[model samples]
Every structure is written in C-alpha cells, then in structure tokens.
Target: MNRDEVIAATRQWIEKAVIGLNLCPFAKSVYVKNQVRIVVSEAKHVDAFLEDLDRELEFLAAADPQDVDTTLLVHPTLFPDFLDFNEIAGIAEEAVVEHELEGILQVASFHPRFQFEDTAEDDIANFTNRSPFPTLHLLREDSIERAVAAYPEAESIYERNIETMTKLGLDGWKALGIPGMGGEKK
Candidate 1:
C-alpha cells in the first residue's frame, strides 16, 4: 500500500480495534478531540525512517498539545520482522532524548506481528498490540499521567486487553478487516 493507504488502514484499526474495542480508555478522549496526528513515513530504509522520526519528534515537541497531543508514525515497509522493529524501537526512544524530549514524551510500539513474551506467536493476547503496520505512538508524558490518575485501576489495562482480545479471538480480529492479520499464521 502507498502512504495514504497505509495511514488509512492504521486509522481504521485504531477506530475499530483500539477505540471500538475500548482497548485504551484514554484513546477516545484525545482522538475525538482531534489531538492525534497520524504520519505515514515514506522511508524505505531504517536510517531514513529515523530521519523522519527526528523531524516528527521536533514537530510534536514544538506543537501545542491542544493542537496535537500525540502522534502515530505509521511506517509501512521498513521493519517487517518483530525483532527488527523492536531493535529500532529503542533508537526511537533515544531520539526522543536526543531531541530533549526525555520525560516529556514516550514511544509506544505496535506492529502486525506484535507478540508478548512467553506467549505463543498466535496467542490472542498478542492482538492487543497488533496494528495494520509497524507504528510508533508518540505520547505526551503529562497527558498520560493525567489520564492514568483519572483512570481507575489503570494497571489492569493489559489484563483487560487480553480479556477483550480473548473474547474476540483470532476469527473476530480477522473480521475487523485489518490487513496483515488474515488466514492462519504462517
């Protein structure tokens, strides 16, 4: 898919799986407020993607939270393997610090093959973090803190998501029409 197509798919997944399923209690608030920025990266290589990430970090740091509270950098073709994506994800965190955004921002990763440790590859819990494409969700620390404080039992989100996905199961996920999550696991 092209950049726009990829971004559209990412948005669909967010609307359907994340918000529709209520995986994140805080997402709907910012999302409906138009505070979410989705940027589709045209970077074909890892280094190129990092460069794009640098610019995005600068943009998020400079923009007012009311205008853009968070960003989702949707990268379509760079890291197909979960291990490779996980490795580059570290560098993404480092970039935030390099941009002097430490403690101000953080990166949450989502991928087509997102897998939880100690779980089978096809485990339903993995779907909780799965997205149509490899994405870096840049969020403001203060906003997260506020949301967490207001939310009851925020620590139970993970377990709650697992429960949600387990209820949906793989067949249900496929029914959501998210790309890269079709047919049986290879």
Candidate 2:
C-alpha cells in the first residue's frame, strides 16, 4: 500500500481500538508510511500498556493485515538520557532484522525536560524545522539496494543527514555550559 493509505488506516485503528482500550495516555502520536509511534509520559507501566496494544494489533492484523504489521517499536520513558539519532537508527535496523518485519514501526520515549540540558531550544527548533521526529520513512527492502544504487539523490540525502548530526553532536553541544551561556569558561 502507499504511504498515505497506510497512515490513514493506522490512524483509524488508533482512534477506534487504541483510544477505547485506554492503553496509555498518549503525549504525542504520529503515523507515517506504515508506522505508528505513540509516546506516553507515564511509561512505568509499559508491560501492561504493550500487552493491551498487542491485543489491539492482533485484532487489526486479523481484520486487515495490510494495515498493521507484526513489528512494533516500544520505547519506554525510562530508556536513557543520552540516546542519539544513529543509535536509534541502529535500533530500527536491528528491529527490522530481528522481527523479520516487512516494514518498521518505531516508538520513541524519553523525558520531555531532558531537552533542556541535552539540546539548545534554538537547535531543537532548527532541527525540527528541517526534519521532524517520529517521521515515517517508507522503505521497501526488496528494492532498497536497487533503488539506492540507481538514486544518487537518496545517497546524497543520507550523507547530508549524517553530516548534519555529526556537526551537531548527539547532545548538540560544542562544549558544556556555565550558568547561562553554552560552554564552560576555561
């Protein structure tokens, strides 16, 4: 199915089944491609939450396998304070391989306030303005190698993204800070 169709179907499932179950209080939710990411503030009860989500997904799969895939990324709020984009990308790659998923579904969770120390508000704004998180990237594995080989533009985009993140660092810091300004006084 096309990306838009996949997203629309996933949204319907969330509204109908997920919301009704009260599985978790969604702090933020995004659907792209065929993936759905739901972030909740209170993640202490992730097991119970995933249990319910799994059940709903089962129903969805039975009814419409095209809409819901077996692979899911469950990111509990207590994950870590220092996870970076490459780390997350690696996790996604691992998930795809481990689950034998046709596509990926990623859920990322972390403390909302963590950004204050980890990233500049301006940097965050700039990053989000350029590329928003919880974005849906449609990848057809069967054709990915061929597509990449054929598409120079795709390779360019990938390289640029890596370069940008490297320049910014995972924490977006040239150096640690004093009280107000970034970077400690030497």
Candidate 3:
C-alpha cells in the first residue's frame, strides 16, 4: 500500500477495532480530539527506521498535549517477523533513554503479528497489540499518568481487552476488515 493507503488503514483499525471494541479506554479521547498523530514511515532499512523513530520521539516530546497527545510511527514493510519487530521495539525504548526523554516519553509497540511472551501465535489476547503494520506508539508520560489517574482501575484494562478480543474471536476480527488480517494464517 502507498503511504496514504497505509495511513487510512491504520486509522480505520484505530476506529473500528481500538475504539469500537473499547480495546483502549484512553484511546478514544485523544483520537476523537484529533490529538493522535499517525505517521507512515517509508524507511526501508533499520538505520533509516531508527532515524524516523528519533525524529518522531523528538517531535512528540516537543509537541503540545492538546495538539498531539500521541504518535504512531508505522512502517508498512519492515520487520515482518514478530521477533525482529520485537527487537526493534526494544531499540525504540533505548532510543527514548538515549534522547533523555525516558521519563517524559515511552514507546509502545504494535504489529500485525504481535504475540506476547509464552502466548500462542493466534491467542486472542495478542490482538490487543496487533495493528495493520509495524507501529511504534510514542506517548506522553504526563498524559498517561493523568489518564491512568482519571481512569478507575486502569490495571483491569488489559484483562478487559483480552476478554473483549476473546469474545470477538478471529471471525469477528476478520469481519471488522482490519488491514493485514484478511487471512486465517495469522
């Protein structure tokens, strides 16, 4: 997919699955307010991707909360394997510390094949972090703290999301038409 198509698919996934399924209670507010910035990276190499991530991390750190609460840096074709993407995700976290924004910013990851440790590849719970493409979510620490404070029992969100996806099932997920989930292979 082209950059525009990739972005559109990501937004659709955010809307139809993230918000529609209430996978993330904190997502809807920023998303509806247009504070969520989705950037599709064309970086083909790991070095280029890290550069993109650095730029985005700086951008998000400097951006105002009302203007940009979070950023999703997506790469359509890089890191097809979950393990490689997972390693890159670790590097992203290191980048946060390298930039000296460790306390102010955090990196979250999502991929089409996002599988948690010890979980089956197709476990419904993994869908919680699954996205159309490989994505690095840059979020403000202050925003997260505030959101967590306002949200009662924020710890339950994960379990709730798992339950939600379990009920949705693969067929239900497929029915949502999320990009990259068109087959039964994943």
Top candidate by lDDT:
3
Candidates ranked by lDDT, best first? 3, 1, 2
> Which stretches in model 1 have alpha-carbon errors above 4 Å?
183-186
Model 3: ten consecutive residues of lowest lDDT: 177-186
Better of 2 and 3 by TM-score: 3
Highest TM-score: give the candidate number: 3
Q: Rate the local accuracy (lDDT) of all candidates.
A: 0.89, 0.34, 0.91
Please give, for residues 19-85, the per-residue lDDT of candidate 2 as tens digits: 3222222211222334333222232553554443344333333433234332332232333322353
Q: Write the number of the candidate with greater lDDT, choosing between 2 and 3.
A: 3
State, as a TM-score between 0 and 1, how close model 2 is to the true structure. Answer: 0.30
Off by over 4 Å in 2: 1-42, 45-76, 83-95, 101-152, 161-186
TM-score of each: 0.96, 0.30, 0.97
Question: Per-residue alpha-carbon lDDT of model 3 for 1-186, expressed as tens digits?
Answer: 999999999999999989999988899999999999999899879999999999999999888889999999999998889899999999999999999998999999998988899999888889899998999999999989999999999999999999999998888999999778653554
For each of the candidates, give the backbone clash count. Answer: 0, 0, 0
Screening candidate 1 with a backbone cut-off below 3 angstroms (N, C-alpha, C), the clashing residue pairs are: none
For model 1, residues 1-186, the per-residue Cα lDDT tens digits are 887788778878888989999999999999999999999998878889999999999999889999999999988888889889998889999998899999999999998888888998899999899888889999999999999999999999999999999999888988988666552442
Which residue runs of candidate 3 sit more than 4 Å off their true CA positions? none
Q: How far is candidate 1 from the true structure (C-alpha RMSD, Å)?
A: 1.3
